[model samples]
Target: MRANLKLKFEKPLVLPIHYNHIIQAAILKLLSDENYSRFIHDQGFKYEKRHFKMFTFSRLEGNFLIDKGNKTITYFDGASLQISTIEEEFMKYIINNVLLNEGIKLIGNHIQVEKVELKHMDVEEGGGRITTKSPIVVYSTFEIEGRKKTYYYNPKEKEFEEILRKNLIKKYMAYFGKEPKDKYFKITPIENLKESIVIYKGTVIKGWNGIFEVNGSPEILKLAYDVGLGAKNSQGFGCFEFI
Candidate 1:
């Protein structure tokens, strides 16, 4: 069983926000130039898709703790929908209508309070080296409502998981100021393919005769293929050198 990964935060009551406002904030933040680009790239890496189609939505309802001795100002809760497809505009429509709005009947219904704040929680799962499960599971807690989420792709899973993970990170970073740093996520293939399990986007590799293979790794080979490293063959690339 996967362990439950969670985080929590608290704020004093000063102001209240209607559910619609939170949705708008999320949409505004996600569509921003920086956030969108990051979201796109991350999706690209995860889905291995030339283009990324994404959509998400949430519905929230909670109470703010109002007490001089206690500090709980705002509450947030919502569900999410993510999809990847070749049709770009179709995906955008879903995000704009369903995911962004969560079908909120009234934008004005947002309850305003004295104070405002946001809290966040995240669950993460990682898989590598079946024999070694030391870090297969990682749990991180956050103090703010905003936080980033990252997902590592397993070749065995459906094609879209990676893309979703990357975009999720972009979404979180846009909300939070910091991004999580994990050595596992940074994994790029090592010089020798036999020993390496994964490769990164911009890895540098040496081809045959110690020359940089112009075409890069071959795409057909099961073990090693074209990424940042370039093309390759199954057994060996004719005694090529590696970085």
Candidate 2:
């Protein structure tokens, strides 16, 4: 399930350039269920040794101005954000909490929930085209000289697709408690593949934003649509929309 939230502010909304963490914090705050919130935050659904929050969100969309000097972005108009999750319970809590609250805070800025729209996307057997709502992130970490270093992959690399496929498979197992019927899945960039660099909580995350052709099992495709593609999904990466 996916929810598109339209937010209004009495004054111009000012935020730092790296505000993904702020948006994440606001979402967690809106959860009315404290236990559920803590669970998703501290320890999500576990698969093997990995944890999957089973949710992803898009970057804020609206008119905005970037202040290089102050390192901030100010939104003159209202903003819209898309949040998705495979867990129905999480979606329910988000909607209920949003409707119940008169207003919410986004980095100390009061934001009114103007509208909330829900959408369910259907994936066919052959799959179809998709455009990223947030950049798709795929990477691996390594230890060198007792120091941890991360390597981010571009879409053109073979490892990028391989890692994404493996990630979807793991997510499938994590959510369904069994492997998908058909494990075949592939993602290829169609056009306008651009690298996106985002700094989340002081960590530099490299990702890609573009339109792509995805061919896979309908079940796996649907799961990717709901949970997001690639890695760091719960941190606001890999959100895509069927095009």
Candidate 3:
């Protein structure tokens, strides 16, 4: 399921530029059903090389209200954000609670949600490949000699392209509990693809949010759209919509 949420604030939401993690944590706080959330969050493969969240979200969109002194952004009150996932119950919970709740706080004590509007999206399914209307973010990390390294996967780099492809195949297996072969889909970053370096909660992340082409089974492609296409999805990355 997918939803577009419009929130109005009494004043511009002043927050640090690297507030993505804060937003992610706020989303998690809404899931009061601890048992179900634990199942959804921790049921995935805990072994090496497979860590991901099932859902995805778009970066914030709106005119900025800037306060250069503290290096904070004051986003306009009517700004919007999009969240998506294949889990139907979770989507319902968001609409019924997150959006419905009055005066919810985000980022810090100052930013309060005065109003919310939720709109459901109708995305068509069944195609060999699909293009995203909104950019999809791709990212991952590697360890080199005991030091952590971040990678921004894009089609421009042939090796990273292959890495992304294999990573996605593993994600498919983890989600559906099926043993699937690699090459199930071909993910190609398209023209106008751009690299983005984001800082979330003091952690630097190298990622890309841009157009991508997916060639594979129609069902799998649809699932990719529903469940997002890459890692850190639940942290507001990799979400896509139909072109």
lDDT of each: 0.26, 0.90, 0.63
How much lDDT does candidate 2 score? 0.90
Which regions of candidate 3 deviate over 4 angstroms? 40-49, 65-69, 108-148, 180-183
Which 10-residue span in candidate 1 carries the lowest summed lDDT? 219-228
Worst 10 residues of 3 by lDDT: 125-134
lDDT by residue for model 1 over 1-243, one digit each (tens)?
011111122222232322323343433343435655455434432223233222222223234444435422344332221122222443354244433443322223422222222222111323221111111111222455576543333323343223323433443333333443531222222221221221212332222121221111111111111111112211111111122
Candidate 2, residues 181-225, lDDT tens digits: the string is: 999899999999999998999988999999999999988889999
Q: Provide the lDDT at 79 for model 3.
A: 69
lDDT (Cα, 0-100) at 219 in candidate 2 = 89
Candidate 1 lDDT: 0.26
Candidate 2: the clashing residue pairs are none
Task: Write one digit per residue (lDDT tens) for candidate 3, span 133-233.
Answer: 33444556689999987766565776655665566666667666775543456666665666666676676666665566656655466566766765667
